[model samples]
Target: MCFVAAVVWSLWSAWHLPSWDRQMDLHVYIGAVRAVGDGVPLYEYVAENGDPFTYPPFALAVFQPLGWMSEPVARLVWLGATPVAVVSIAAALTTRRGIVGRRRQVTLTLVAAAVLMVSAPIQSNLRFGQVSVFLVLLAFVDALDLTPRPVRGVLIGVASAIKLTPLLFVPYLWVTGRRRDAMRAGASFAACTGLAHVMWPAASTTFWTDAIFSTSRIGNLAANGNQSLNGALIRVGVVPPERAAAWLVLSALVCAVALVGARQCHREGHTARGVVVVGCATVVASPVSWTHHQVWPVLAGLLLMAGPRRTRMAWGVVLLVAMTFSVGGWLPAGFARENVRLLAALAVCTWGLAPLRHRAPATVGLLPGVRLVVRPRTAMAYAGVVAVAAGAVMLLVRESPVAVRFETPDHRDEALWGAPTNGCEGYTSTLRADGTVGYACESAVDPVGGRQLNFGGGRGGSSGMVTIQGQVGPEVARLVFVPVEGTKALDVPLLPQPGPGSAPLRAPEHGRPEMITSGPIEDRRLPGARGFSIAATSTDHALLLAYGRDGRLISSGGEKLRMG
Candidate 1:
């Protein structure tokens, strides 16, 4: 309870914070609900009332209650509650007969902290009003042994229906010779998903058509080019992702084979750590999971340590490194791209199955089953203790000040934009001496280069009137600054053409001529390049130099921002 309390508090402290680089998916779920309440359809082509539903159907269902409350209020409720649920899961699986020893307790504490520190970027989701942990925890409950046979089966099925990723576990259950278990769970899941659909067709329809489609939309995002294995392949070779499905299928098949072997390893009385294998299998089965998504592996690591604490050490170090990099934002865009996230997931799987390396599964379960027996090791094992204790530390330490500074306007703001964040990066808007205020992308952070957006104010939606409050005085005029990425240059194609309501303005950054230029800038066709990039210069000023196809600047003066 103390550990859980600590985690909950940490999350609460981070509540309602906004970050531009992180908190990608978390906002989408909550924002869609707000939009639904505001009369927007789930998957509107033009971002639907400025709320994008880019999550699974079950994700939307989970947010129904949130829709009734204000965004800030809902974020507070979630931040305070979800970590407790996560810790409860850790406790449920690690505690034997509901009794925890000092060593195990410490291990849990460390593991929790480590998760917070390493996956601090995940904190972005929590602060920005996201609900990823719920899905993660729900799926975990499905795999636990706390329920009756029938109830357990349904739980797994329902979890799978919510996020197709959990489907990764089915092969493990089957290979571990839990075929019947899989069927029962599948039945329950089918029923839950069907029931939800029948009861809420609007949400269901939008999820299948819009929300679900949003996830796959990543294939086209330049930011993804840095964050996922799917992106890595296309990036390294400069080719279309032709082998992704095949690779995913192959990985699943391997896990299936491993599952069968792990089952046999269990049946043959190998070792006592099959608990770890089950967890690792879950990770290896998926392709694009993030660090927080891998937290459950700690449970698998604990199970391995419970017996002979051998295999987990190597992988634990590997995992710690993986997570540390993830949270620091030091991880390159290709961090998730290189299958590192998959490796972390695999670490858990290895630990879960470690016991099977020593003894048969039935024998292992029997030993723990005997009410009078106590396992020799109680969490004093070196690696397990470190993992959990580090996690606990994370709960208390708070990420570096830099992390706090990277935040967004608020959770509600992040919620307005889904993944790819769609040119909604940070903003550079200020009232000039001329009285006419200007808005532009926060280029210092490279917001536009990543297919992400960097804008200012408002609920953080692309079109929401950007309202800058407080010290800035009453409210400056709101200018919507959109982000464009990739091409290294932007050609006006046509500049400040005399339009109905659009005005000319100057860019403070380049000291470019103000919107009221004295002379006409040259008009020419824009040169093409590798891709595209976007910048919101004051619509007021004429674009002097346009970035050309060869990555060169063509303009009146020689002012240029080079693409690296």
Candidate 2:
């Protein structure tokens, strides 16, 4: 009870009192629910911070009730629920096969919960008010067979419906000879997904057809928080065109090794080890496994410590869990440093499976009359050869082009749009198919060239207002909209766009020469790219004039307006 108190108190201290406005994934969830209530299409709902609803429509349906509550109330409820979920996770893991005494079980659960609270992943989940903790708890309960047989797989199914990664467990159960449970999970998943289709027809169609494959909907996969194998490849400068191919090849290899290792562990009566093995593989294979998604490593370490004492495997698990605490963040930032977590996960997979190498029977060579004995080691060697062959097939793979889509203002249907570009690249806006405008960049590497300005507006469908948005070059220090009717000009400041890493522009070191500029400046240097948006009445028309830092006119452009 004291440990549980510590967990709650830790969360309260971290969250602070009387203020719950810290950021990220939770806002996306709240925005998603609000978008549904407003009758907006799920895919079209971008939170104020520019994140979209990346999960399936089933997730949106599950979260719909959150819409009824005010943001503060919802956040409070979510914050309170997170600790309960964490405690439940610890209880589920500890009580799976039963610990000796009631006292020992309670003690173990409390200790595990406290340790989990300190993990970087769980901390991130709490800070963001993310659903990951609950998802992890659900996976743990179902995977460890804590639930009754008839309803055994329901939680895993529901979890996968909310976030696609848990689907890996369905196959894990099947391959481990739990076919009945796998079928139950599959059927439950289909039922939930089918219901979501009935509730949100267009969103379901759009998601299955397009959104599932569009990596752009999620933030930059190369960001440091992303600790997946695909993320590691991306950070190391894998070319864009071949990324999908490489990801497919590597994901397949990892999944094969993981499934084999997990099956072996399950056969050896080490179910916890099997679950941990599969969990690590799922994190590595997924394209956008964020730091908060690493709940599996925490489970692995806890489960290993619960087993026999003083083994090298137990020490390896300790090393793995310590890595999950994220000492890597203190290291110098680069490709290698960025991939520390990914490498640790890969190490967990390898070391967890290392025992299989020695457990295999030792046989000399093939005889003419006798059959060749293929050991686990030899089987693994064959698997590696197959993996290499499959990767070699990447040279022949051809990718089909896919477009990102946004819902029309009417909320009736979606319109295809080009994906957003890195801020350093030049921006271009075009009237796309279905009458919606789209923007694309020329290159991801080249900096924005020359002073450029472009403006466009769309009729605000049912709201009857107008949304005017445009892009300005780095040189544009001031922009004004002068109404053709001689009304007063409206001054709109160009906001500096963050670069590729979404990092803010920084000033030079203290001793550097001052950058010369005129007019009010937000930073010492003007960003290489900037933009602005204005909300106005439909009847308004204005000429856009941009000025330089020295107060000289940079460019003048006419508003290219689109009618409803």
Candidate 3:
């Protein structure tokens, strides 16, 4: 039933969403992989013309299977594989075959499901085609038994070669005194990393010498680039991006000190549960988390529930909250983004401030919070049950129907580029000024009224640019006129403003006017160029957009044309 519910909910949400991310992040990357496997070059992987990806050659192996199906179906396969991989890992960590009993199964399932639901960052991974889940899962599976310790080490080694973030978990594992596991992880990580280097010699060389070294030094990014709790805090006027990193480091140090203090000062419990707690926080310390990347704590909470009792129940509740936000809450409800950061921070604090020896057995001795105080085996069973139940919920969500639809404006009259009837007449555009024939409705563009512009997905909650195509040379006709909010937008010399020694297209000195455009936008990196891309709904509560070929290529912001 839970599975059915998850399926239903997911389907419903998918259908009703005003605009889906449409594999914006990793989805596009995966799509790129598909293209590559089909013998397409990276240059050909355009979103409009093809897919979006520029992965290392190693990713080629991963994307090869995608070629067996159409793009949409391939995307589904890539996306659909996530739940299975994720839930299975959760079950392995928190629940096992001989772990728990039948009686407590339902409770375990419900709680586990709730926690999994709350894992906000995990969704980001999926949102971006990050594949971090698989990375974490490999480690999670490797960490399971003492027997596989060596192999797990090797896997970590390989994964580390691919992405640096996975390397963070190494200290946690090593500090626990599992030297052999760490060694294996190191070895595997090294081998895989070295292999990646050997295969993508150019990228590998550039990554270490350029990207990695540069990343190590440059600690902050723009608000839009930040994905951490610290980063989000920085975004909402809390702190500067670079300052936030300093504060984060200071805070982590303080927590480490506090955890030591808690060990010597208070003999309180939750030390075991706290271990996983801090793991989540560690993730939030980075600026790269999207939705799926945040799942560390949810997985940790599940494992904790199967560990000691003092804080597991509370942690379980936290999981529920995270899960709630991940599903539909990430959007629609405005608070989901910040809420996710808060939950992750709390987990980090919980673990960081608690005193637990890494090498300590993760057994449930049960000092508090368990009604029956079940045995370790029963606890394991309960945890497994919880994971399965949670998985079921995920499935049900995928199947559910949309409850209510957000209002979608009519778009029927909108001109279709290639459509037969409404097809825009391709013309060798003439550049004219004086706001005369060049800016006229029929000649330059229709000044066409259509539904308000709505970009499917844009960062920072705003829509993308509103684009309309026409013929105009920066020399004569560069003003992109648009009917914005009922008033005419005689957007000034909107092409690249005259560079040094070049002509200058200045905005009018008088009334409010759209920003100026200057310069030719020669190379369009992403597809959907040429055709106008409607960015956002304008202030007039109507629309805003650019016009003409030269109109799109404004060199105003020093932006290199977006490399497709």
Candidate 4:
């Protein structure tokens, strides 16, 4: 059954791969390495889509080869490797400790891999081209006996060097009766950090001192995609100062509880369960755990199924349903639903870590009497159960479609790029009913008769020319760029819209999904919005003046037109 589900999912993913914006994070990874190669400051280098490099300096070094590859090649390599990592994780979880015979273990590993491939978090990782699954597999080396005992924790350390979250495992290894492995892991981490420092001293220093604490660089902490406890609290209206304190307190408490639970699980031989518990704790405690980082929950769900029959029927259902469905969306509070993954991880730690009164049998498969091959008599019964469960998930879960539908004014470039199309960095589409999206730099200018001028500019290349891009309001017929020092005024050209027979705008082949483009429409002249994209030869401040059709000044802003 799981194999069938996996095959179906593979087909579906392949079909949608072309339409979906693929591997945004992978681009950042490659871009960061390339930035270093180009002599750009690692932390200061921003991707074309406006994301800064947030990973450790060592990560850049690791991705240096990927930087040499073209975007398509890098994406292909990442997408292919991610599934292999998932399969490896499943194999490590199922095949270790010899719970079953070799053949049974192989079968169980395949089944687990199938279930994991279809899980929501894994799918999210694949979509974003994230490295969470690979890190998970790396952290499992010691626990699953996948490497030599002498170097069991080295991989965990290396993973930590790429990302700090796995560093939590060093102490975990210590308390779980692997003190030597813990020291080795810590030493390995230090060695990797030192290597990065030697390779790129300035970048390593910047990341360790400044960039590490700049959580905002990763994007909005309270965004729906952030499923950590800190993000959850912020969405619920906690101020930053108080949120910091509360988060620290809550994270400490969770870490304590989860660590204790993991220790118990480790001592009791449920090593995989223990590792997952620690991983869940890490996700919840982190300041920004994106949906892709919640991969541990799927593994937790699988482990939950391995418990006794009643426990499997009760807790197992609760977890798998929560994992499969967006449970937070059903809540009354708007932001509460966004933290469904966070809440689910907490629940997993709560159940997986709590001590048991009686020692349960360590059967690492599905419920008893459930076999890989079913008899003719029971085949119909299993099929009925599977059908009912599938039906329930289909009825209850409402997946947000990847497709976006919004009509921009004038409809020249119908497809908008980068999310939150508020017109700051590039030519963003605006509705222009009454409100301005605000200036690209500072100072907000009020809309004039439901008209807005959204403008931004920056240094283009080594030539030092500044490329300015903006969208002018329909109320303005003539737009002029006046240099703060020069006498000549450059007339900003308005981009023309597509004619009647022009091809309809299509979604991007590679990039983020089309952002929301529809804004309030009150003014009749809003449909005539025009774009301004020009290279300023001189790097100087300029004033943008918008003139109405009646030869009257519509709007003007000087600070908004500064050439960076």
Give the candidate number with the greatest TM-score: 2
Evaluated at residue 52, the lDDT of candidate 3 is 30
Q: Give stretches of model 1 more than 4 Å off.
A: 1-9, 19-27, 45-51, 96-125, 200-228, 261-287, 300-311, 325-339, 346-495, 498-564
Best by lDDT: 2
Model 1's TM-score against the true structure: 0.55
Candidates' C-alpha lDDT? 0.43, 0.67, 0.42, 0.66
Clashes of each: 72, 0, 81, 1
What are the RMSD figures for all models against the true structure? 16.5, 16.4, 15.5, 18.1
Q: Pairing residues by index, what is the TM-score of model 4?
A: 0.63
Model 1 scores a C-alpha lDDT of 0.43
- Candidate 3 lDDT trough over 10 residues, lowest sum: 555-564
Measured against the true structure, the TM-scores of the candidates, in listed sequence, are: 0.55, 0.67, 0.53, 0.63
Worst 10 residues of 2 by lDDT: 515-524
Query: The CA-based lDDT of model 3 is what?
Result: 0.42
The count of residue-pair clashes in candidate 3 stands at: 81
* Model 2 regions more than 4 Å off: 17-23, 307-324, 329-336, 361-375, 383-564
| Per-residue lDDT over 1-564 for candidate 3, one digit per residue giving the tens place of the 0 to 100 score | 554355345434443443355445555555656654566544334443222343334444455566556766755665676666655554554443244775566445544543453345444544544577776666555544423533656665555555555565455445444566766777766766666666556555655565443321122332233446544443333323334444455345434432332232222433333334434544565544545655666655455445447676576556556544544344564435545554444444433234333323232222234322223234334444653554354334322111111111233122322121111122222344534222111122121222111122222133233323322222323332232211223343221212222332233333123222422212111112122222222221222232333222121110111210
Candidates in descending lDDT order: 2, 4, 1, 3
Pick by TM-score: 2 or 4, better one: 2
